[model samples]
Target: MSTNALPPVVDTDTWQKELAALRIREKAATRELDAIAAQRRRLPMVQMPDYVLEGEHGPVRLAEIFGDHPQLIVYHHMWNDGAEWQCGGCTGFTSQFTRLEGLASFDARFVIVTHGPIGEALAYKRKVGNTMTWYSTANSSFGSDVGAPRDGGFAVNVFLRDGDTVYRTWHTDGRGTEQLSYLFGLIDILPYGRQEVWQDSPAGWPQGPTYSRWLDSDAIAAAYGEPN
Candidate 1:
């Protein structure tokens, strides 16, 4: 059928039946996800040195980033080596992390670390209108070690701390980053569903450019600024 054709109209009973059937599959998927998560928690962890990173408040130890929490979730945000702008997808993804108050209440802490200069990272964060806690991996192997420090890439790492020592528990990248963005989950339920070129949408379903159109050198240049 042409993408222009809408889904078949169904009577209330039929619609409810289909919805019920889909819910069964959805529940199955949820169970699988839970199982995987349980396995993730059981995975072995590796010890890491207490590397120093640059935060808005100045230099801070990797362990300090966790504050009082024993668990840390850090996203290695792509900065293209201190470019004027940031990756659009990365920017869009990080924008979702507003206040971590709810997450912190559960004994978890989240922060963003980039290999860019601290000043530049703060400027970019401000320009993008994000309120997340950010730090710089400048002169530190923190990015290359457990995070994706390269351009056009992003990584979310899970770390566990034992007293003064830190251990990397797990890390994920690429589509894995979508796990943090409710937008992708929400869009997945829509008819067009992201509308990206590679998506398995119906033929002629208004597919546009992939996500790469979001940011580039020009945009970054306009977003960078000198701190006051």
Candidate 2:
């Protein structure tokens, strides 16, 4: 298949009718998502112990990361000490969430966590140019406790606070973590989509190996510095 085929052309009236049909399905999807969210809110939560982690501000407790907020979300970024570069996927995730101040109004906060020494984690932060709240789970069981064990796997963990106890509310990983990046949702509606090989596109639409271009573009090594 060529890489330049276009979508089928149709009469204006036919296009409008087709669009209207899609709109109906989209609305149904929105309603279903709302229903799922309502269920998510009602799901049971588990009690979490106070885990210490190091951040830009030095050592802090998991509860302190939530501060006075009732809800917290942590992105378990993949950043082992010996890795040459930070995870490009995690880099993309952090890039989308740097300006999450709006969540604070709802008593929610977001942070990124990694299993590494603080120095290595800070270097990765500089490499990716992410200024969001990032921390290290080194010398702590935070990784295993949250199911983002140091051996492998990344996760987005949700937690809630009641009195002085923190509770695990929810978590997701892999494609589920893609929702963290607004770009993923934005590009999903584009004509050619994400341009990755896995997408369903017209015979001639562009496709390529995933993350090759990602690394070529954003994989530069950089001098280490604390993000203010």
**TM-scores of all predicted structures:** 0.88, 0.90
**Candidate 1 per-residue C-alpha lDDT over 86-201 given as tens digits, one digit per residue, 9 for 90 to 100:** 77777777776676798778788999988888998887887777677999987798888775755436799999888989999999998887878887888889887787898887
> lDDT value for candidate 2?
0.80
Count of backbone clashes for each model?
2, 0
Candidate 2: residue 96 lDDT (0-100): 61
Screening candidate 2 with a backbone cut-off below 3 angstroms (N, C-alpha, C), the clashing residue pairs are: none
Write down the RMSD of all candidates, one decimal each.
3.5, 3.0
Model 2 per-residue lDDT tens digits across residues 78-188: 765687666767776676665788998999998888887888887667766777778889878997788788877789999998877889999888888876678778878
Residue 71, model 1: lDDT of: 95
